[model samples]
Target: MSQKSQNQRPDEQPEEPKADDVADSSGTRAAEPAPAQDEAADEVAPADAATVPTGTDGPVEGPGTADGAPGDRDPAGRDALDRALTDDMNFRTPDEIRSGDATQYPAHEASAAPEDDRPSAEAPPEPDAARDREPETAASLTADRLLDARDRAPVAGWRRWLYRATLGRVNVGDSDAVRLRRLRENSIKTPLTGGTRYVTVLSRKGGVGKTTATTLLGMALAEVREDRVAALDANPDRGTLSDRSPGQTRYTARQLVQNRYLVDSFAKISQYASRQGSRLHVLASDTDPHVAEAFDDADYRAVTDLMGKFYSIVLTDSGTGMVHSVMQGSLEKSDVVVLVSGASVDEARLASETLSWLEAHGRQDLARNAIVVINQSAGLARGVNVDEIEAHFSSRVDSVVRLPYDAHLAEGSEVSLDRLRPATREAVMELASLVVDELRGTR
Candidate 1:
């Protein structure tokens, strides 16, 4: 049995015991052979023990086996299969076992906590009333320097005797005191905010002043707007804006739409409007043209939503029947469209075909924001061209004014902005400063 291990070659005879190389004897530890690998290490097989050879001396140690080491355990019964896979592995180290990595498990490193016992993660402390707050800029988001010092204009004993007879160079070279200081800075600048504008004088044709430009633009925006301005004849027929502000209220707007929930505030809808001068509120129409043709469109949206909860400039007038049923609540509550037109050539071809029927009805932005006034009723008429009707409504309009023939707005009766004449009250204060500079350039 010893000739050199008796010249051994029945296939060299050493690997025969493998049913996991059985050894237990109720005590275990026997099968240990495979170790010698490092001939510069990688004959490549450790992808978690490619078909498992973990530590029959070559790879497995403590991270229960299939390669992730921790050091000692092989003898082929595989340390009772590394104590039954160390109750299912994940024990790592020997440089995370020949670099195959991913083994961090003691309940995942105590849930990876330690950044100085981390609780905060930063962003909380802000509101001691927003920490003395002062950030919003763009000039404090449009700083509104408290205005409306009620209707300031008493210094006219001829502008305080021409500012003491020219000590102030004829009151700073007054072209009517610089057009009343640009119509009091376009009627005290900021009005249109969120609701109620609806200007709409409108006139497909009816002695075109459209209730005298809605009673002179609601008395020139209630004589320089401190707000609340209305007019609303919405003509159905016998309108004439209650014969132009002939007040003392016979309560029309069809008795405030049949006592619309007792019309709340603005002094109960200024007792069915008509006031005319301390901030012009008219709302007339029902002078019986068969109860003003049964004033429809939900009674003009219940009298303009109860004068839009007390008027921020309504105006309306609206009639000469442009497909009337009270023009469906004045062309869906207008939002600025004066349009009048009586200088002639059939009133500028019916005000350019009513702005080509408001751009064929989808209101092409209310016919491109129409204004087109031209009410020089009879005087501007010797075959009137008035600059080709102001260059054909300034190319279908965002403004074109005119309004001159005033025998006090042509004897329509009650309008008395001190009986208007200083050049028709400076052409209705330059047409209410071009409709309050188109309502502060669209808010």
Candidate 2:
């Protein structure tokens, strides 16, 4: 041994092994720390054994200490190379390295670990309800048992189109407009009660579409309602009401009066009436002026009383003259009165005056509940304001429906209910709907 070695202290050790020799003894290929959770452990590799000398500042490297991970703190003595490699590593406390504190880890790794932001599960807050409610079981069931199912087939519009395009793979509900239209149809189909309902259509002036309004109201009501509807022509003048319909009988209201007692069944009464379609039966008045003039209040009552037995609804097309006996009979029995008017100013004034006349007479309730229809309107012609007419009547009456001038109706020929324009049909239905609501309300 050298002189310096012989004089060494008891704690002092001989020269440490070379890095390669240290690796061979530790069973590691290089004098590098084994892989650990912390990169700091692998960073400080052992220095060359030959370059190190006996030292009292720190302990010497033992069996596995040279290659031991810095993150570990085992019974084996720690490597001596960390002191010599102090200049190579970032500054950190020895206690920090020994305990493997978060500070000892790499800058990016320590920052990459996320801090938990969730509230602790312990001492959870109380539930909003009295106690915890278990989840509902209905959601797990199939949709077929529900009223409006999520998987129901589409009926109209873009959803229906998409469903068809995809061979029914896609499904959705009908559009809002279609749904509302269906609701309207269903509303019109509402059943009537309290025996038969009597509806009368009249106007103070001639050529105001009174007969046409009567036909439309009867047709619209009969189209959806599952009951027979009858339209009676009580015009004092020779009525062209039958000419507006496709089916007409040579028999007039006079037949119903003469055969009143014999008309015990619908088959007998159907002879005096001409059925326009499946449900609307039109009872025409005499075509001759002198003959129609003779058809009076007794005749009107006879016809209505007989038809009322077979028909659930009877619409009276009253004469322009309010003082006509048939008109009086109509007003007397009418559950709902419809006052038809033209869009012109004179026509509107006449309609309003006719309402006033009703109020002055013993028929104030009839006038108050009457539905006013402004018809044959071609929009803003001859300085006429249809909207103003509608508004005025709306305030005085139960409802006002504007029948826009449709080309098919303008021809004044036989009327086809389905051939009317959409706007005209909608107006007609609106009037019918109002009449139905009034009938049901009066009941």
Candidate 3:
């Protein structure tokens, strides 16, 4: 404040700051203010532009800011008029500055130490850039390499030549069809989690390709999966499951049952099983009528118990006779049931009745979750509408698959995936996928 305003004011406007009052001899505002900041201006001398005393006759030096230096202000005086100084800091705090009475901001340090150099408890410390950083992980470091690298290398056709010619820079991926084939193969290759899973192939009548369907289903699963797979010809009558394989073992399901303890391991079980080129194991029932006729649930429990220890999956080729004792155990132990039907009306009717029998006999759970296979292995559908049969079964079951006729399958010889028609192989693949879906559904 200037002298004229001090004496002339009761309720008067303050005088404008003179240029000399805001600056010092060096033209900076870092200099101290008047010794008695509230003293009348006339008592202070203005001759050499030096210090002035307040209550004494002589002048004395002023106290310093908290950090031992006076703060600089805008030369235009906006900051000088509005700013108030406090104990801790006079300038250079990050934000949230506190203002109070510390106007004696001399350019020199006071002999005494500051009350607290640590900082006020309410004001946060200025953050350190290095202190708040997160550590790097392995995934973060390899992210670019993983994203930019090629997952697959072209092996067949001109795609291989183009990749080699460009020094492996230019690349094109596999066709959508090949990708779909890969995905389909992967779907069936899903791991079988629990102990051995059982799948039963059933039909109310024989000759609807029920036996052929079992052979194909076993082959499809065994072709890709590394786990042990067995198809049991537990058909109450002589089952031909072993005949579909290129070679046959002399031992039968009867031998496996009677000598169950001998087949304690898969190596020993191999004596009774006919191992196929597709990696499928066929455990056939006796060709003798009297022995097959006597195969019952007690025999079934013994056979399955031994098979379960060695195989990851067991498929039972059940007979048309629902009254057969083996059929009861097959249905009871089965995780999935494949009900086979031909493309004829009578075959469809008989198969549908078998499904109804399952529902009526307190196995409604199996009926609802059953997979129906419409066997078109006859190579002709001249007079019947196969669509109606499929739709009928579709309403009652979880899924339905159609098997088209293959020339090799019709020959009643050893089955080979390479020999089957593409349509036939595809139908079997879809059926395998559905069976796998059912196995997972059981979990």
Candidate 4:
């Protein structure tokens, strides 16, 4: 058969003949449709019928298949897709959809359900009342409360005066007063845990204020910290650390070393050392220069170990020699180092050289982290650059702080924070703060 005749669809196939029309010579039966009937049947088939398969390997009978039994079609299959594309259902007006009149679109008969069970088209439900309500805000939630916490107390200094002047109210502290009060609180609030922390004040040259720095630093720290703070004159030479504090006892560090076995409590330790007020206690060096030179590393170990039991922090005023045996013991126990220098060129160079020596030695880390304090004992020298000195040391050290000359400090009498000038006090407070911060970090 020709390809055109072979491609005719099964539905358009010609009907078989009756047995009478197919009678043969030996009474055999043959069946065939008339040529006129085959031609007429082919004429009625549509061109799109080319898509329909005619062999045994034809498309399987399934939902929507042309040859699929109507009873076998999936009843749940949706005709919305076909109606949307081929029928006028997509062109329906909103009013027609809301009216629910299916009879208006007879072309959508494929989608007609025996029982209309779709949910009624209605507006969305009103949002739940609770969900629609406004959320509680931070201010609204806190409106009823009367207290608020702070890391530090509020200021009361000038604020009080301002309120009194404007609103005729008193007892309101100003910001400055609050700030100073908080600073005072923070200075003294050192926690009483961990092993004793040691701060050593050292200088390679004498008269550069090593002992002075040690005494004042101890005073500042002791005044603020409630815990026990001590200044130890670790100078192998007769030192003046005790003169900075009230000399209550004739016993020196040597006496403490000899009597270390008996020095167990603060009471016993107080016998050899003198207390400056309540917080700071001072252990004086040997008064006789000849005997002070004999105070070696062994004596240092004995004294500090005994003091460590009673003090939270110990400020050692080391001698004017880095190679001194006492300095060895001081550096060994020191957690922080305060390198003291004068504003003079000679003194500053000496201090820098001392740091270099420390670096050359095994204490490079300590030297790098050490605090450099330039004491302005006398007036500034002519043609001497103090800022350059400060900058130079600052680059080599963790921090460099300048100590301004105060009449009280110049006198070298018993060091007291109140006796010092306001600027002097501020500088010391800053130094104490840096040390406290360092302590916190190490812990």
lDDT of 4 by residue, 101-188 (tens): 4444553443455435544567567689999886643333321133332322333456545655765434343355345644644644
lDDT of 3 by residue, 160-179 (tens): 67778888887785555555
Worst lDDT run of 10 residues, candidate 4, spans 69-78
Please say which candidate is ahead in TM-score: 1 or 4: 4
Highest TM-score among the candidates is held by which one? 4
The best-first sequence of candidates by TM-score reads 4, 2, 3, 1
Cα RMSD for candidates in order? 21.7, 18.4, 13.5, 12.9
lDDT per residue, candidate 1, 1-443, as tens digits?
11333354545544445554466666675555444342113233244434333435443444334444323333454556656555434455345445545554454554578867667859575469665784443322221233322223325567657667766544432345654655454454445677777777787877776787777777767766667887877766676777767566677887889898976677888877768355787878777544424677788888888888878878787778579887867777776677878887987898899889888988887778777878884467676668888887897776787878878777767777777766666666667777766765664
Cα deviation of 41 in candidate 4 (Å)?
Answer: 21
State the number of backbone clashes in model 1.
Answer: 2
Q: What is the lDDT of residue 67 in candidate 4?
A: 30
Once fitted onto the true fold, the runs of candidate 2 whose alpha carbons sit more than 4 angstroms away are 1-159, 276-278, 289-293, 377-380
Question: Which prediction has the highest lDDT against the true structure?
Answer: 3
